[model samples]
Structures are given as structure tokens and as C-alpha cells.
Target: MRMNAKDEAEMEYFGSTIRLQNENVTLRDTVQALNAALSARDDELANIEDELSDRENEVTRCERALELRVAQFNQEAEELVQQKEDHRRLKLECKKLQNQNKIE
Candidate 1:
């Protein structure tokens, strides 16, 4: 028995359609797998970003602490210099008074 020409054409078209459908299914699966991997990578990226933000805040705090310490040191040094100058002036006054008394 031979297939009619119209029936054979119909069968060929059906085969092509089935093959296209299979190819579409494979492409869909590949896309789904890629999406899953991308989602996992996105989670990792978020974690890394959070860690970097935390480090940046910590650095800022340390910088502030260092600035405060530097300011304190400067103030202390100024106070020490003033005290030394005052001591020198008092000694000079005392020596002048002794010299005047000795001349009399």
C-alpha cells in the first residue's frame, strides 16, 4: 500500500513540527539552568557587597579614632610648651630681683 501524496506531505510537516518542539524543549531547559546559576551567583555577590560595606564602616570608625587621638596629642603638647615658658619667665624674674639686691 502507498501513501497518498497529500498524506505524505502531511506526515513530513508533522515530523518537522515534532523536531522543532523537541529543540524548543531543550532550549528551555538550558535557559532554566542558566537562570539558576545566575541566581546563585547573585546571592554570592550580595554577600560580598555586604562584607565590603562593613569593612568600609570599620575603616571610617578607625579613621575617626585616629583623628581624635591626634587632636589630643596636639593639645597636650601645647600645654607642655606653655608650662615650660612660664617656668623660664619665673626664673628670670627671681634672678633679676637677686641681682638688684646685690648691687644695693
Candidate 2:
């Protein structure tokens, strides 16, 4: 049995339609996979940014604490110097009184 021209044209059209449908399905799958990958990367980037911000805040807190400690140490050092000066003056005054008593 031989196919008529009309039948041949119909068969060709059907095959072309099937091929286009398959290609469309493949393209859709590829687009979905790409979108999923992009979404995952975006989420990862956001997490990294959050971690960086937290570390920066911690660093700022530590710096402020260190500054306070330094100020405290400076104040203590100044007080120590004042105490030493006071002790030296008292020693000189006591020596002068002893010498005066001996001369009298």
C-alpha cells in the first residue's frame, strides 16, 4: 500500500510537532534547574553577610571594652604616682624635725 501525498504531509507535521514538544520540555527542565541553583546561591550569600555583620558588632564591643580597661589602668597609675610623692614629702619633713631636735 502506498501513502498519498496528503498522508505524507500529515505524517511530517505530526513528527515535527512531537519533536518540538520534547524540546520544549527539555528547555523547561533546564530553566527550572538554573532557577533553583540561583536561589540557593542567593540564600548562601545572605547567610554570609549576616555572619559578617555579627562579627563586626563583636569587634566593636571588644574595642570599647579595651578602651575602658586602658582608661582604668591610666587612672590607677596616676594615683600611684601621687601616693609616692606624698610619701617622699613626709619623709623629708620627719628628717628636718629630728635634726632640729638634736640641735636644740
Candidate 3:
């Protein structure tokens, strides 16, 4: 048996309503997934920032140690130069005394 125009119209309306409800559910699920992804990314960013800070602190420590080593080397170099000068003066004095003794 063929349906009347009224029954056909009601059936079309019901089908359209079901489609709209399905589309609404799909949109809600998509929004929830995007939010979760964004939260995870934010957590990763925070961890990276912490690592960067730690590296910066390590670099500062290394720089200070290098400066201290440089200072120590400079002091050692100065002492060596002074010792050489003293040795040369002593040798010259010994040579003068030997020459005088030989003339006498």
C-alpha cells in the first residue's frame, strides 16, 4: 500500500532530525579531542623550558671554572719569569768574582 503525502513528509522530517543529531555528536567529539591534544602539548612545552634552564645554569658554572683556571695559569707564568731573572743575575756575579781572582 502507498503512503499518503502527510506520512511521507513526517518520515522525511524524522530522517533529517536524526542526521542533525549525529552531526552534533561528531562535532562534540572532535572538540574534546582537540582540547586533549592541546593540553598534552602544553605539558611538553613546560618540560622543555625546565631543561633549558638547567642547561643555562651548567654553562654558567663552566664559565666560572674556566675563569679561575686562567687566573691560576697567569700567576704561575709570572713566577717562572721572575725565577729566570734571578738566575741570570747570580750567574753574572759569579763570573765577575772568578775573573778578579784570576788577575790577582
Candidate 4:
């Protein structure tokens, strides 16, 4: 069976229409896949940002704690110095009294 010129033309037009439709479907699927990938990456970025923020907060807490400890150590060192000075003066006074008693 031979296809007349008009029938051949109609068949070609339908074939072209089907090809165009398939291409459109493929393009739509590609766009959907890209959108899903972008959404996933956005979620991952948000999670990473949250983790970074948590670490920053922890560092701040540690710094504050260290500062308090350093202040406490400084106060203790000052007290120790004052106590030593007092002890030295007491010893000098005791020695002087002992010498005067011996002379008497």
C-alpha cells in the first residue's frame, strides 16, 4: 500500500508533533529534578548554619568561664602576698623582744 502525498504530509506532521511533545515532557522532568536538588541543598545549608551558631555560643560560654577563673586566681595571689608580708613583720618584732630580755 502506497501513501499518497497528502497522507505522507499528514503522517510527517503527526510525527513531528509527537516528537515535540516528548521533548516537552523531558524538559519538564529535568526542571522538576533541578528544583528538588536545589531544595535539598537549601536545607543542608540551613543545618550547617545552625551548627555553626551553636559552636559560636559554646565558645562564648567557655571564654566567660575562663575569665571568671582568671579573676579568682588573681584575688587568691594577692591574699597570699599580704599574708607573707604580715608574717615577716611579726617575726621581726619577736626577735627584738628576745634581745631586750637578754640584756635585762
Candidate 5:
């Protein structure tokens, strides 16, 4: 039996409502997936920041060690120069004693 226009119009309205509900569900799921991907990206950025901080700390430590080494080298160089001057004075005194002994 063929239905009248009124019945067909009601069925078409329900069909349109179901399609709208499905569209809303698909949009909600897409939004959730985007949020998850954004969270993962944020975590990766944090890890990179942590790695950079570690590297900066290590560089600071290395610079301090290099400064200590340079200071030690300077101290040793100064001691060597003092020793050389002492040897020069001793050599002059020995020569004067030899001339005095020859005169006597």
C-alpha cells in the first residue's frame, strides 16, 4: 500500500535527525584524536628541554676544570723562573771567591 505525503514527510524528518547525530559523533571523535596528538607533541618538547639543560650544566663543569688546570700551570712556571735566578747568583759568587784566593 502506498503511503500518503504526510507519512512520507515524517519518515524523512527522522532520517535527517539520525544523519545529524552521526555527524556530531564523528566530529567528537576527531577532536579527541587531535587532543591526544597534541599531548604527545608537548611531551616530546619537554624531553628536549631537559636534554638541553643537562648539556649546559656539563659545559659549566668543564669550563671550571680548565680554569683550575691553567692556574696550576702558571704556578709551576713561576717556580721554575725563581729557581733559574737563584742558580745565576750562585755562579757569580763562586767566581768572586776564586779571584780572592788567587790574590792571597
Candidate 6:
């Protein structure tokens, strides 16, 4: 089958057009896939940020609780020290009275 020059030119042009269309379709699909991947990554980043914020809040709450506990412990320690001093004073007074009676 011999193709005339005009027919040959037309066939070449048709083949070139088909190749260009295929390339365009491939490029479109690639761009769509990349966009989808980028969107998923952005969502993941947002979720991580939310989780980080929550954890930071929890840490702050724990620090406040610990501070309260420390304050309570200090107050209780001060009370115990005052009680011990009172006990010591009473014991000394009782001994002094007993010695005075013996001297009389």
C-alpha cells in the first residue's frame, strides 16, 4: 500500500496530535495526584497541631496541681513545729515546780 505525499503528511499530523493528547492526559493525572497528596498532608499537620495544643494544656494543669500540693505540705509542717515547741515548754515548767517543792 503506497501512501501519496499528502496522505503521508496527514498521517504524521494525526500521530503527532494523538501523542500530544496522551501527554496532556498523563500530565493532568499527575497534577491531580500531587494535589491530593498535598491535601492529605495538610490535614495530618492540622491534627498534630491540635494534639500538641491539648498536651500542653494538660501539662499546665499538672503543674498547678503540684504547686497546690507543695503549699499544703508547707503549711502542715509549720503547724507540727509549733506543736512540738509547746510540748517542750510544758515539760520544763512541770520539772521546775517539782524541784521547788523538794527545797521547801
Question: lDDT of each prediction vs. the true structure?
Answer: 0.99, 0.99, 0.95, 0.98, 0.93, 0.97
Range of the 10 consecutive residues with the lowest summed lDDT in candidate 1: 88-97
Tens-digit lDDT track of model 3 for 15-104:
999999999999999999999999999999999999999999999999999999999999999999999999999899999999999999
Runs of candidate 1 exceeding 4 Å displacement = none
* Backbone clash count for every predicted candidate, in the order shown: 0, 0, 0, 0, 0, 0
Which residue runs does candidate 4 get wrong by more than 4 Å?
none
lDDT of 2 at 2: 100
How many pairs of residues in model 4 come into backbone collision?
A: 0
Comparing candidate 2 with candidate 4, which one achieves the higher lDDT?
2
- Write out the backbone clash pairs for model 2: none
lDDT of 5: 0.93
Q: Give the per-residue lDDT of model 1 (tens digit) for 50-96.
A: 99999999999999999999999999999999999999999999999
Clashes of 5: 0
TM-score, candidate 1, is 0.82
Q: Is candidate 3 or candidate 4 better by lDDT?
A: 4
Residue pairs in clash, model 1: none
| Stronger candidate by TM-score (1 vs 2) | 1
Q: What is the per-residue lDDT of model 6 for residues 3-42, given as tens digits with 9 covering 90 to 100?
A: 9999999999999999999999999999999999999999
lDDT of 6 at 58: 99
Q: Write the residue-wise lDDT of candidate 4 on 59-92 in tens digits.
A: 9999999999999999999999999999999899
For residue 102, model 3's alpha carbon misses the true position, in angstroms, by: 4.8
lDDT string, candidate 2, 49-98, tens digits: 99999999999999999999999999999999999999999999999999
lDDT, residue 9, model 4? 100
What TM-score fits each model? Answer: 0.82, 0.80, 0.74, 0.82, 0.73, 0.78
Winner on TM-score between 3 and 4 is: 4
Judging by lDDT, tell me the better candidate of 1 and 3: 1
| TM-score computed on alpha carbons, candidate 2 | 0.80
> What RMSD, rounded to one decimal, does every model reach?
1.9, 2.0, 2.5, 1.9, 2.6, 2.2
